[model samples]
Every structure is written in C-alpha cells, then in structure tokens.
Target chain A: MTLCTFIKAGLLGGILLAAAPLQADDLEIYGFMQVSGSSQTWDEDYGASLEADGALVGTWIDHAQQANAIAGSEMFPWQGLVGLKDNTRNDISFNLQQLNVILKKRFNRQWSSFVNFEVVENYKTDYAQESEWGSFSVQEAFVRYAPSARWTFKFGKFVPTFGNFYEIYNRTPLQPYLFRPLIFEKSVGGILPPEDYLPNTMAAQVSGTLRTGIGKLDYALFLGNSEESYFAENGRNDTDAKCIGGRFGIRRGLFKAGVSGSYDYDRLDALDLGNDVVLAIDYKVPRMRYGVDFSGSAGPVSFVCEGIFVVYDLDSDQQAVVDASHAAGTSADNTLDKSFFYAHLQYDAAKWFVYGDYDFVNDGIQPWGKDGVNALIGGGGIRLTDSITWKFQVAQYSYEVSVPHPLFGAPDPLAALGGDLTPVNAPAAGVYKGTILDVQTGISIAF
Target chain B: MKYTLTLLVLALIALRATAGVSVIAHPDVDAGSVDKITLADIYSLDLLALGDSDLIVFDLSDADPVREGFYAAIGKEHDKMKKLWLRAKLTGSGEPPTAVASLEEMAREVAATPGGIGYVDSASVPKGVKVLATFE
Candidate 1:
C-alpha cells in the first residue's frame, strides 16, 4: 500500500479504538511538544586565487561573495561545490519543532499495538516557501507480541535498534541539549546526514533481553526496504536487495554499551563529474555501516560516546567508468567512504543541567574540497516543572577545506568577460576557511 | 529535664513520619517475596509477567515520600524511571504503571485488581494485601 494510504488507515484504526469503551488499564494516550528559536552568526575567510601554468591570473574576493549570495538556495545546483559564504551575517527563526501524539492499547498480556503521529515545524502542505511548510507523518505504527520474558517480536514500521540516541533523540524533554549532537539531529540541515550513517526505520524486528549473572544482555534484529534517495518517487526498494541490521549490548545498573551494524544497497541517481556540472547516472552500490556506542553515569555526571563508519564498495567496472569521467575533465578521485564521531557529557542536578559535546564528520566525496567539518557545542537547561523544561545552547562550527581541487579552474564563461581574465590550466592551491556561531533557546512540554 | 523529654517526643514523631516502605501485592500473586533486582525489573516495565499471570503494577504520585523511598530502594532515580517509562510507552513494549493519589488509594487499587503490585508505608500495612518485601 502507499504510504499515504497506510497513514490514513492507521489514524482511522486509532480513532476507532479510542471511540470504543475500554478499561483504563487497556488504553493510553500521551504525547509531547517542543518549540524553539535560534540565531546564527557567520565569519568566513575564502582567500583563493586562480592561476595558469604556475602563474597567478587573479586574486579576488568574488568567490566568497558568490557563495554568500546562494547560501540557502537549493535551486542553485552548484551551491554544494562552492559551499556556503559563511560571511558576516545573522539569521534568526522561531519554530514549533514538534508535536507528537502516541496511542497505545494492550489487548492481552501477550499482545499490544502502538501508533505515533508527528507534526513538525508547523507543517503546512500548501505553503509556497520551504520554511513556511513543515511535515506531518506517521513516525511509527507497530504490533508487538511477547510470548516469554526473553523473546518479543514486532511487525510494522518502527525505528530499528541502532546507536544509543537514534531511538530517543526526538523525545526533547528527556534530552539535555536543545540541539542534539550532529548525528542525532534530524531537523538540523547539517553537513553530515544521519541517514547516510544509520538505518532510520525497519519493517520488522525481533528483540529480547537475558538476565545474566553480571548484567542484562540485549539483542535485536531487524529488516527493512533498501535505502533510497531523499527525493525518491516512493519509499520502496528500487532493487531486489533488502536492508538487514542488528544491535547487541549489555546493561548493568546505570552503564550500558552496544555494537550495531547494517548492510544495504544505495541507489544513486547523480554522479559528480568533478566540476560544478551535475550528471545523472543510475547505479546501485553495496553499502555497509557499523558503529559502537556506550553510555554511563557517575552520580550527577553522565556521558555518552558513539562512532560510525560507512563504506561504499564499487566494482572495478564502476571504478573505471568513474576514472574515465574524471580523465575527461570531470575529476578522477571519487570515493564515498565516510566516518563520524561524537562525545557528549552532561551534569544533571535536581532542577538544572549543563552539557557539552563535540561532533566531527569526514565526507570522502569532498564536494567542496573540504576534508571534514568539526563542531563544538555547549548548553544547559532548567526544569521549570515536572513536565516542562527550558533550554539554551551555543555551538561553533569549522569547515576545513585544506586542499584545492585540480579540476576547479575558474569558469571559462566568467573568464571570457575579461574583468579578471585568466586562461589558467589549473588554479593555485588555496585555503578555504569558514566558521559559524549558532545560539538557540527552546522549551519542551510533556503530557 | 522537661525540655529534654519534649525533644525526645519530637524526635520520635519525626522518625514515624520518615518510616520505611513495603512492596505489597495482591494475594493472588504467586511470588512470596522479590529481590531488589527483580523489583527494579518489574517496576521499570522491563518484566511484564510474573509467573503465569500478567503483572499489573501501580504507582503513587511523584509528590509522595513513599514513592521516592520505593525508587531509592530499587536503585533507580525518579527522572531515570520517567525516561524509562516514556521509552516503553512510545515503543509499545509496555505502559507506565497506573498512578494513584495517596497510599490509601494505592492499597485499595491493588486489593481490587488481580496480579497487582504497589508500595506504601510499612507502618500503615493495610489489610487485604500481601507484603512482598519491606525496605528501610
């Protein structure tokens, strides 16, 4: 069935269940809401030069100006290549981050069902501006059966067990930071995309826990449709391959650790031919991701750490094709390997909390000639009441573009104008440095 | 001497106010007593069934001192417990225990429900319920 149809059917089922007369012990309705406002300031220095045959053609700041002009414009296809201007500017916005509702019913000791509906950024379907429209979706709808204490099975759509934070990150009231770590921030349009690093949802899952002598051992296995592009026509696998993953961990008292991995096929519709031109090339490459995560607490201080590695395996034929495109003036080196890491520390008291975390991502594609991006974030929160919390955060980001691409010569069309004319075979290696300072404040309420 | 006697009486009253709590269950429950680990598992919604019957757990409001003492005895913090319950409820694994306003209500609910469990002050051990464990 189509996703829209499935959502409508799920909502109808939930409404019908709510209308029925059931005991208080059988049905439950709960949810939470979060709203926030944020401001960002940028400071960047793009001291790049164009040269021909080892001689300087021109030294201009126009590159930085052009980058700034298309900072947030998705319509500009070359925005990714030039990167953002990161120039001295300030941007502010207020958003209803999320309003989530959950309906659950217990049919018996062995069977139960759950449904979660979410409205984010005040979602409007007909709005013209992207910022004016949000999203409304059914995050999860699943039925669970537990025949014994050590075995439980689930079917439907739900987030697979991966990492320590992916499953609970959206529960804002439970999180210490208004802005989660980069890997877990689904709403943040960061350089590192979480979908590339982890599996977000699965069709079926089997999970259980064992009470061992030392601690409790937990394990989960899940299956789902293969990964698809963000703009895929439908949320179905394009190939016969499916995504499979699992996580295993142990918990004792307040400390727990887990290892998780997934295997799938990624469908890519476009290929980067080195320069600013976007080429459509359809290919399904084998992808594998693995990660480790651990969390623990000592009195009032709690900390969590996680790291993920992704590898895209291309056959020799595909490699040769990529090489041919690069030799034909596209850029030869094309790699899709990526790695990410983050560490978070928080001190929670009776009525308040303070936290700090660091995030790093290395994109092997190097769309902007940058090796990686690093972010250092700090924040704190106050518990206004049992169900209400107010939080604020400050984050600093550094985009490291330490190397210059050989294929990135000044556009021939621009050079023909003669304003800063340069018939350059190759551009001189230049450093591109950019940074952003972001501040945010928000409140979350749980009911 | 009179002042010392009055101070002694006040201390006794304070001791009674901070008395220990007892983990009580319906007489139909099979288990006679539960260890600290088992208690934690059950109250956290990690363990849904005890023996052959499905467990029906009840809780007192957060403002109750007996509720705090019960969690401390199980080696869990209030905030952490709330998070655990939220995760359980959202994931469809389990639901949070039904909460009653006072100890008297807790006793009454557990007595009327099958496979029921709750906690209350040890000094006020009401009738019609079986004390599974007591913590000081």
Candidate 2:
C-alpha cells in the first residue's frame, strides 16, 4: 500500500520472473556478524553552557556533546564479516556494522540483474516504545547492466559515484577512523543519507572500464536532485536544486590515482537558499603486498567539524527544506552554508592497517565564532580471516565555542571569572569536549 | 644384426594402433567427446569445461597441453577463458563459466540439459551419457 511496499514487490517479482527455470542449485549464499565495546569522555558537561568568565571557559565534559566541553567514550556492538563467493544457492551478503544483502540473478551469460540492500536504525519514535531489535531501512535498490566488454549502464536508487569511499566497501584502507571525516559528516553534498550505505546522494549513473596503453581506466557520470526537491503532479524535480558529477581513475603498475568533483544547485519550494561545489583527489601505491592511500579535498565550506582539520560544505538547499518543514511552528535553525577541508593518510597490509585523520569546518561565520569540532584520531586493525577484522582506536579533541545558558544572556558572569569560562559560538547552543576509547571487532562475508 | 633389426620393425608397427588416446563413446551416439573433436561440432555444444578439459568454445582457462592441443588442431581462432570472464565482469557483456562445486553436479546438470556437455571421472559415466575421449 505504501511507496516502499510497492517498490519491494515490483523488484521481487522481477527477480522471480527472471529466474523462471528456477535452478536453486545455481544460487550462492554468504554473510557475517560482529560485536564490540567503546568508551567516551566529553570535554564539557552535558549542557556545557558559557560561564560568567569569558576566555577561561571552553573545556571538555559531558554525557552528551554540546558547545562547552568535550564528550567521550560510548561503546556498542558492531558487525563485521564477509563471504567471498557462492553459487549453489542464489544469495549475496555483505558485513558492515550492519547486515546487508546483495540479491542477484544471472540471466544467461550477457545479462544479469543485482540489488544491494541495507538496514538502517530509525530513531524516530520513543526508544522505549520500540522493539530492541531495531528497525530497518532499504538503503539501496538498483539494477546494473553491462552491455559491452568495457562499458555499463545502471538505473535505480544507488550511491552516486563521487568519492572513493562512497562506492567501495572497507574503510580501513581509505579513511583514518571507523567514523567518516568531519567534512563528510557535516558537508552539504558529501554526507549522503544512509550515511554508511553509499557515497554522494541517491542517483542514476553510467560508468565503465577501458584499456589504456599501459593498464586501465575507470570513469563514471551521475545525475540526481540536489539536496532539495518539490513534489508536484509530475513527481519530484530539482526545481532549484540538482547534483551532477563524475569520477575518473587510472591504474598503472602498482599505483592508482583518482579525481572526483560535483556541482550542486539547491532551492525548491520557491526559496533561493544557496549552492555548493566539491573537488577531491587521491593517490595510492601498493608495495610489499600492502599499500598506502593519501587523499585531500576542498570546497565552499559550511560543514561542521567532527574532528580537527576535516571540513565539508553544507548543501544549503537541502537544509532549507528541513528548515521550511519545521518553520515558525518549531525550534529549528536552518544552516545555509559551510566551509570544510582536510587530509588523511592510511597504510593497509592484508587485513591489518593503521591510520590518522584531521578536520576543520566553519558555517557562515568566522571559523572560531562558529564552534568547531577539532579532533585527532589514530587506530589499527587485525584481520581474523579474509572476511573478519578487529579494530582499536583513540581520539583527542578540542572545542572552540561555548554555550551561554538561558539566564546568562550576552557577556555573562562566567566570562568575568576568567579561566575556562567563555561562551562557545557554535551551531549547537552548548560547550563540548571529550576523549574516546573505541575497541571493536567484526567480520564480513559475501557470496 | 639384420635379423634383429627386422624383428624390431615388426614390433614397432604393432604398437602404433594402440598408442593413440582411446576415443570411446556410446555406440549409439554419432558425435565424439574426445581430445580431438571437430571445431564446428565443438562450437555447437553447450559445454562445461571441467577442471582442465580444454573446452575451447571461446577460450582456454590456462595455456597448457590440452589447450595447446585444442588450439593447435582447430587453428588460432579462440580466446582464453580468463580473459573472457574479466571482459564480462568489467564490460557487462558476456558471463564467464559458472564455477560448479563438483564433477557429479556438473555431469547431472549437463546431462539433464540439451546440447549440454561436461567432464566426469571415467568410472562415473551414466548410461544416458557417453564418453567422448580418454586424454591419457
């Protein structure tokens, strides 16, 4: 009856019909599971508001992170495991921190269809009213078609091909932390929904492989609605927002280099909010049976910093939608712009790796005035098998702004008292700071 | 010495008849599934090249003796199986051979399907199926 249900039914029917002869023996099945523990510490208290003292205020402390102090240490179970193959029974699985399914059917030799699905935790209702098992969301549903030896066309709701980590699984070899870069989290166009599902926003894409003089070349082009859209008699359209992008990469000897870029136009609902553009590049070399990946990028920054040095631009147009959705009737501040930049380095050998990351983000104001989340993270991993891995990490963080309480107003007494008692000028009205010890292990199997 | 040479010549002539591979089959079946099958006939088969059977319908998996024989006898026309799979996965055109779990399953699958052909241990040959050749 619902949109989601209709989509699921249609896809399922398509697969069954395609498997008419029904060779159960032709299917392959695979999957994995994982568990972990983590601890967190904040630089400020739960509501780290500004004190009477100004310069001496900002500090880390809290059960939750706000503008005042740093919050630290939270732990839980994480999934990890993967199966490399299967053909006896038609099934495909991927182990992320979540259980993902890859459903595919081989229609003869030249054509086949595939669908990738992920489960998302919906924290919409009262946690108490919900079942402990958690709810699920279909992160991706699409079909891929390769009609030639080096070219392919795909249609459906799939992650756009914009960033290296967006389409590729396994972050140990690409990013520095288990979490994404700050720029990735707060940036406008880079932080796609189903955060961990894929990269860029959902859209249609065309990509392919080509033989070069020395090795090979890979490229892709994608088109999608920007961060905002207007629903009309004809369905959805960019109206004022749209995202168009592409990625190019080349392989030579033991090295690979790539570049990605995208332009976003955001509006919809008759409001001229703003826009965004992003450019990124990365290079990698494999030696000693392992390798190193180095990456960096910059754009019209408006994203919030999850850690130091990392940055991303906010999709002003999309933010405007949420802002409009909750207009005067609610307490919501629609962020219009953001500035971001960062660099990361990682070394991966077989199943083991080590990494480091940094970020810096400012939204529509002086970098320091707009409270920032500056952090340094380091970590490592141990491969239990070809499909499972264990991870360990630590982070050091600092905050720039403070949250003034309801009573304090401007130039509060807390500022006069001196040491560590200033107001934090940030998107969230509170002070924040913290340390965290993250220990987790998981496996991934695919078939 | 002359008598001994004459005796050796007689023995050698007797060996040639049995030296070639035993291209066996079900007496009722007209086509041969052997090391040296006809190119036109080979192409017609919906064949399963087991382990290393050198079913050069399109290409060879490896460049070895059986493969060499197939190409040598058929002329240079086919491609390698490895290249074909890579091409299919990358280009989205054709698919590579399905990797089956065992010879028994391969035989059953091939036998049940028309135009199907695959390899199995000589001892396991079923009644409906026929042995095309013995490589050894």
Candidate 3:
C-alpha cells in the first residue's frame, strides 16, 4: 500500500478505537458556521468571496485551510514543509463548511479519552476531480490520565502544548475578526506550520497546573514526531526520529504570560539523477523554535502578543536537494531563519468592540517590515444576540516581494513604466510592490 | 400573535417555578458542598474527580433556567459555557457534562451513578440524590 493509504488507515484505526461506541445516548454534538462576504482588492485585481467555513467535532473542519491545521500545531504534531503552492484564483464557488463527529468516554476520573472524526472537502483535488464528496480526518484521538490535580499525562494523538490560542481557534463567534492573523497563516507556508493554532495531532503530551503565592502556573511538555502534522498534505515524518517541546505559563488574575519551544530533525533524503541531475545529499536539519506570549484582560480591554523565532541549520549547498526544475529559486545559503510577531488589542464597550491587530513575518533574506508580507487590521464586532455575532474588519496587507502571496496574487508588471499604465506583463527592472485591501463582514453563529 | 404571547407568558410562569437550583450529587459522594470555582472547574472538566471521589458530571438541558441560573451565578454565560466545552473537546481536553432531558431525569442519573454530579430545581431534588447546596 502507498504511504498515504497506510497513514490514513492507521489514523482511522486509532480514532475508531477511541470511538469504541461507549454510550449512544451520551454523545454530544456542537459546532459553528462562519458565513461571510469578503471583498478584496489585490493591487489592481478586485473580487468578492462568499464564504462558509467550519473546522473539528464541536469545533468543525475545513478543506480550505492547508493540511497544516494538522500542519504543525500545539494541538497536533510538530511542523513541516509547505503545501504544493498554487497561483490561481476562482471568483465564485460554494464550499460545504464541514462537520465533526466526536465520542468522549470517561472511565472514572483518572482516565478519559476524546475522539473526533472530521469530514471536509478535499479542495486540493476539488478542481482536478469533479465528483468527490469529502473525506474524514482525525483531529483529536487521545486519552488523558491524571494522577493528581496538579499532574496529567496524555497518551495517544493530541495537539502539541504550545500557547493559549491553540485551544481557542474554533470559537469564532467570540472573536472579533473572521480571518486569522498573518503570523499563523504565514508560518504554515514559510517554515513553521499553523498546526499550533488549529488542529492537534497523533502524539503525547504531559500537562498540569499548580497554585503558587504569586499566581497559578499551568504548563505542558509535548514529545512527538516533528514531521507528523500537516495531515492534509500527508506530511508525516519519514523516519523514527522524535520531536520534543513544551510550553510553561503563569496565570495571575487577569493576566497570562508564557514561553514555549520545540526542536525537530528533518532528514532530507538522498536522491540520484543519472548523470544529468547530479547527486543530492541527505542532511538532517536541527530545526529549533522558541517564542514568548502574553495576554491580559482588564474588564473592557484585552490584549495578546506573541513572538516566535525559527532557525534551521544545514552544512550543504542550495542544489543539494532542490531540483533545478522547481520554479522558486533555491536558497543560496545553508542557514535558514525566520521571525514572526503578532499582537492584538480590543476594547469592548456597549454592544460593539474596537480592535486592531499587527502581524509581521520575516523569512531569511526577505525581512519583514522591510517589504515582507505584513498585515494591519482594524475591526469591530456587534453582538446581535447572545448566539449570533456580526463582525466587520478591514485588513490592510502590504507585500514587499510578490511571490504568489495567496490573498495578494503575484502580479507585477512595471519596474520601468512611470504611471502611464504599461502592459500588464511588461518586463520590470525592480520587484513588484503593492498593497491589498481586504474587507470582510461575517455573521457568525454558535449553539 | 395573541396565542404566541400567551404561550410565552405561560412559559415564563413555569420557569419561575423552577428558578431555584440545588447542586446534587450521588448519594455516596464525599463532599457535602462545592465552591463555585470548584463547580466551574468540574463543569470545565479541569477537575476530573472531585475531592477524592471520581466524578461523572451531568447537566439539565441547556435551555433549563435552573442550569442557566446556576452557571450565571458562577459568572458564566450559556454561550460561553458551550464555547468553553467546545474548545476543550476539539483541543482533546476533557468532555462536557452529559446532558439529560430535564431536571428530574438529571436528578435520577445523579442519584444512581456513584460519582455523578448534577443540578436540579431545589423543590424537585429526587430521592437517593444528595443535595450539596441550594442557591437562587
């Protein structure tokens, strides 16, 4: 059987075992649907999207997001490489948000298990294969064991233990914005995956809380295959090596702060090309990631800030594993690095909220703020009712280098034309520069 | 419209009759009372077993005013409660309380299960179910 088939069968088996039909009458079901009308102007290209999104059991799932929800999440496995890049856009389409089936079993107090099976559209192949329903992906299939109130051991597959937001991504109705910040979105395609923010994976984690004089401390240490997540793309690790990391945080009244880190090894394979292709060497990347996060809530105001840095070192050349035929040129150096920063502040008074978000990503030579993709968001939410929320946000996106930045298509035509409106594909001496205005209004529901 | 308003008024009157909530547990549960924070932790599944005894939490249907009032008294909204459990389940944490159809049904379940904990109208606390506390 193929690797994909093997992985799918194993994942299905694990979740099904956790799903062992406990009590039919005790099953609980819940989820949310985020329906929105989004209008975006990518430099000169303008379009509007009618959107319906869902993600987990109780949570919901989506084929629209890259496999990285499984990609590299504190909730899933570790991080991995990017999905196959696409540079095309469709104006009008309908997507069935998705649904989740969950079975939670509690065998006394020390042992309990959670199993979730999600069915989401396979959008990657939706266009290629017209006749397709959806497929099931295991978001969480894990058992928890607590020896004491201060100690808990989790066995089976689960999301990594990272920061605070990993556990709250699906509660969209409570959030003021419909779209994720640039930090989570960029890290997925860049070096780290967005798994930490969305889905957890098949792994093990130990977590607990302790009371102190100053505050209560909660922490988790996760050990698993760094390459295991990104399930949508079938990007599990190819070897038996393990990835280890954890997060430790303190909660003092209305404020919370924490630090988290993870380390992994990606064993690049050795490839052979008869005579013409030359030899590709196998190398192991000691990938390291570390970040700090802080959150505070003071009555009508709340804020969160997080910063993560990634370093991947290699002792080889650019052409070692990069095939010559690939479109994006290979990196010229052996050491790869990235820094991501995200912060958000919201003030809620009356029935409405005033909020702003600043997110930036810096990858190697293409440093952020120096023209890398950066996003500025200003938005608010109106609580139409307790169950329904109406959110409107304007996300201002700026890209210094235009390489198929999904929201902002890669279309640069003028380095030479002075403003007379040159041909759309004319050759240019400089890089493409432009700002994208993305305005979205969403009516979110939760029950 | 007149009939709908009349039905609404009747429903309000019925809810008022059961507005008071009594925290109930298995007859053999060790604790005679539970604090609001501990109650919240139990509902959130953060505190799995309560005070040396294993626990299986149950709740009246979300629409029950007593259940709503109990959570509201503990500084939680019904919507936020759902979101909290939703996040827990999706994130692979503990499960939400199993929901019973009504206060009577929830009381019956709590009475029979060794470690079961639930809430019901104070006036309707069934036999074999121990009342931990009564709050309005």
Candidate 4:
C-alpha cells in the first residue's frame, strides 16, 4: 500500500482499539549521534602480489571486489551520522535511517517481530561500491519467539549469530570505538556485493539459551540458501547450506567463558564441493576492583579475550579451477590457513568507561611467517545523560607479507586488476600502518 | 456497691443488644447451610455493595439465610470485591453487573444472558441458576 494509505489505516485502527486512558504508565522520547575519523596505511608496495591472500587475492575474479582496494586510494578522513528512536508502551520501536526503516514489536511477553529496510547508495571507493546505496531494501526482517526470558527463536534476515563484535558490541550504546574490528572491516567477505561484509542473507534460525548444572549452554541451528539465490524466483535448492552449532560456557559470579563454532558447505547444485568452518572461544573476568576517596568511586575492572580458527575444505575440482585461473595471469588465488585473536580490558565506573583492545589475524599457517595482520584500538567514553554519550578513540592496522605482484605494484590482486575490472584471483602483500583518531558522541531514548 | 454495679452492667448489655444490625434473608434458604467466604473467593465472585437506594432481589418465603448472610458479609468492613468492581468501572475498563429488584426479575434476565453471573439470596435461587459459593 501507499504510504498515505498505510498511515490512514493505522489511524483508523487506533480509534477502534482505544482502551483505558494511559495515565500511570511512563512515556519518554530518546535517540543518539555518532561521528568518527579514521586513518589507514596501505602496503608501501600494494600494487603487486594480489595472489598472496584469499581475502584480497580472490577478489580478482569478482569485479565488485576489486573496487574495495584502499591502497593508492584517497581517504575519507572523517564520517558521522545521527539516528532517531521511538518506543511505545506495548514494546514496539521504530528507527529510520536514510532509505531504511526499522520496526520492532513484542507480542504479549514472549515473542517479538522486527523489520529493517536499508537504502543503498551509489558510491564507489577502491574498497567497495554499493549499487543502490541511496535506494531502499529490507536489511533485516524477522520474527523472534522467546519461550522463556533467556532464549529466542528468530526466523528471517539477521546478522550472523556469531562473533562478539558482530553482535552486541556493534550497537551504538555499547561500542567503545566508532569503527568495527579491523579483521571484520578489512578481510571478511560481505554477504552483499562490493564492500557488503556479512551480506543480508535469508535464513531460518533456532537459537536458545540453556542453564545446566555446570553453567550455561547456548546453541544455534541455521538453514538457508545462499544469499545470492534468496530472492530468486526458485530460491530453495538442495545446494542450500545447513548450519548447526552451539556454545557452551560457565558463569559463576563475575567470570564467564564459552566456545562456539559453525560448519559451512559451498555448492551450486546440491553437490557440496567445498566447506568453510570456524571455531571460537571467548572468556571474560573481573581483573581488578578498587574504590576512590571521592563520591564518584570506580567499580570493578574487567578483561575479555577471544580466539577464532577457520578451516577450509576445498575439493580437487575447486583447486583445479583456481590453478587454471592463475595460469592465465588473471586469477587472484587468495586463500589462507589462519586464526584471529583479540583481547581487551574495560573499566566502567558510574557513567564513565575506558577500554583497550588488540586484534591479530594470521594470513597463513606457518609459525612466525612474514604474512599476517595486527591492530590495536583504544577508546573511552562518558555518559552525558541517560540517552547521550561521548567517546574518543585511536586505532592502527598493519599487514605483513613477503611477495609483491607486478600489475598494481601491491601485495594483492585488486591492485593488479587496476580498477573495477580486477580479476578475483590476484594476490598482494605488504606492511601498511596508520593511526585513527576519532571523537564521537550520540543520544538515544525510548518512549 | 456490688449490687448496683451488676444492675448497671445488665442495663448496658440490654441497650447494646437492641442497637446491633439485624440480617434478613429469603424464607426458603437454610440459614445455617454455608460456612465462611474467603477474601480471594469473594473478589472473583463479583459481589455487589448494598446501599440505601439499592433494590435487592430475594424470595421472602424460603428459610435460607442467603440474603441475610450475604448482606452481613458485604460493605467496607467485609467484602472487598464490591470496591474492585467499582474501581474497574471508574477506570473505563470492566462493567459492573446489573441489579434486580425481585427474584423473578433476576431469574428471567440472568437465564437468557451468556456467561450470566449474578447473585441472589440463597433462599430465592431459581431452577436454572447454579449456586457457586456462599457465606454465613
């Protein structure tokens, strides 16, 4: 229906459903603002060796991937945005951003449904290009049913139910810095085209939390077709992937630890040709507790860290295809056996908090190899009001690789491909470093 | 002095006895049939409050204490259910049950309504109506 018709219909329903006057129930209005500035370093020799790494080297085949190269590219230096929030007594909320509109509703006390539409913009950077950046599309739409207070069953499009930063820390109210983790920002393939990391894929997921005698157990069962075929005319196929995994953790008082993993099968016609699987473990504990003499006393200081390992199972045919593409001087074969680790410490007292995180991603399986990525991020914030906060942070990312490709003179293939037409199989590696200084603040309130 | 004191005490007791309220009921109802009513039960039962202008319905021929017993169990000092109904109505939520002036009126009206919930003197209960609970 048209926007006008939709609005009219809601108003008509409101009149007919009017109930007891709302006097005792509380109502409030809230939202937030965030602004950040970042500086990055590229391989001093980023024009070559696009074949050295899977994340960058494989981009040579997909034209869209070639555009994401940041080396030999101009930097934005600074970016910011303001978002609005609206919540009602019945547990419903609305957030509108550019072409995207999000709505959430809680049914009775156990179930809820949410829908988010994002408009793509038409813009291109060496790193990626979003075709419909300024256009509208459903970013996340799903229904969540919670049988108890701690578990949920969600079916629809949502962020992958994995990784710490991918879930909770990504929210504006909780994040320590304006930018996401570097491994996520730089290496992970987006679920969407161009720079769309963790693309909007359609799937049905059953996830819940369990309280056992030992501690707590959480699991997720997911099944869905490749994001590319989700919206197609005939979307369901045997080739569709299935995922099942669970996280086991123990929490006694202020300390908690858990491990989570998932298995993925890549196929075109139900014939599974390759697989991608990942396992991760995370732990958090209160490291210190101290009080100051002033009325504003500091609370407990905590430490959190996690490690993730990804194993690739490639079939002979897949290996042959990459070999053939490489012989033609066009394919950028980038694949790696590696693990990513991150550790951070956070101290929160009253409305003020400070944190420091170190992230590491190895490009290959060799010990002390000359190929890897490491980053350090530090930031802190103070709450100015119940719905508003301000933060400042600094970050740095560096890459280590030995080989250099000839085409783009960088360590990766996107540089070799030169522009949007770069082959997906090229490889490039080099040490690039820079510091990010960002100051951001925002407000959020619910009614 | 002791004789005079005893005589004075007897006079005071006589006066107090005459001043106390009297409970009335329909002639057919068994006056001593029921036991005590709980606070929770009374709330769920949705009993009505009695006032000077209110018209209560009951058969006068039964010997049951339905009317007198219920009458005694109501008011600010007894049943809280009456107040809850009034509060619900004032808040624009629940509607209070209707009042009838006679047993005949009550039976004829309540028998036709769906989920018909009403109260009458135990002695005045009609053929179709069911007696859920009562108090002495």
Among these predictions, the greatest lDDT belongs to: 1
The segments of candidate 4 whose C-alpha lies over 4 angstroms from its true place after superposition are: A1-33, A39-101, A118-137, A186-202, A226-238, A267-299, A320-335, A363-370, A401-404, A407-447, B1-136
Give interface RMSD for all predictions. 1.9, 10.2, 3.3, 18.1
Point out the higher-scoring one by DockQ: 1 or 4. Answer: 1
lDDT of 2 at A259: 62
By TM-score, how accurate is candidate 4? Answer: 0.47
True contacts kept of each: 0.38, 0.00, 0.24, 0.00
**Stretches of candidate 2 above 4 Å error?**
A1-34, A49-96, A121-135, A169-177, A183-200, A228-240, A267-351, A359-372, A402-447, B1-136
Tens-place lDDT digits, model 2, residues A1-447: 356645655664565466555547444222222333434443332223322222222222221222222111121011121111111111112223444444556654334665544432212222322222323444455566654435666666666665444443322222224444454432123222223112235468787666566655768888766542333467576254456667777655334556665565432224312111111111111101001122332221111111111123434554454455334212113433343444555565544767666654443222122454465767667766444556666655554433332323333333443424323342244433333333333333322
Name the regions of candidate 1 deviating beyond 4 angstroms.
A1-27, A47-86, A123-130, A230-235, A271-282, A320-334, A368-370, A402-431, B1-14
Which is better, 3 or 4, measured by lDDT? 3
The deviation in Å at residue A427 for candidate 2 is 16
lDDT of 4 by residue, A1-447 (tens): 446535544553453244213222321111223433333333322222233222222212122333343333343111221111111011111112122233444443345565553333222233233322323344566776655424556777665445344443223444555544554542132311211122224366666555455544545555544335323456454543444443444443335565555554332222111111111111111011111110111234767677666554545654454345334333223332345677778787667888888877663322112345567778888767544566666666555323223223334443343444333322333222222233323232211
Angstrom error of the Cα, residue A328, model 1: value is 9.7
Candidate 3 per-residue lDDT over residues A104-216, each given as its tens digit:
66665577776666544323323433213335566667788876657888888766667656555444654676766764432123333463222234377888887676877
Q: Candidates' DockQ values?
A: 0.53, 0.05, 0.22, 0.02
For all the candidates, what are their Cα RMSDs to the real structure?
6.8, 15.9, 11.8, 19.3
Candidate 3 versus truth, CA RMSD in Å, comes to 11.8
Error of 3 at A291 (Å): 2.5
Which of 2 and 4 is the better model by DockQ? 2
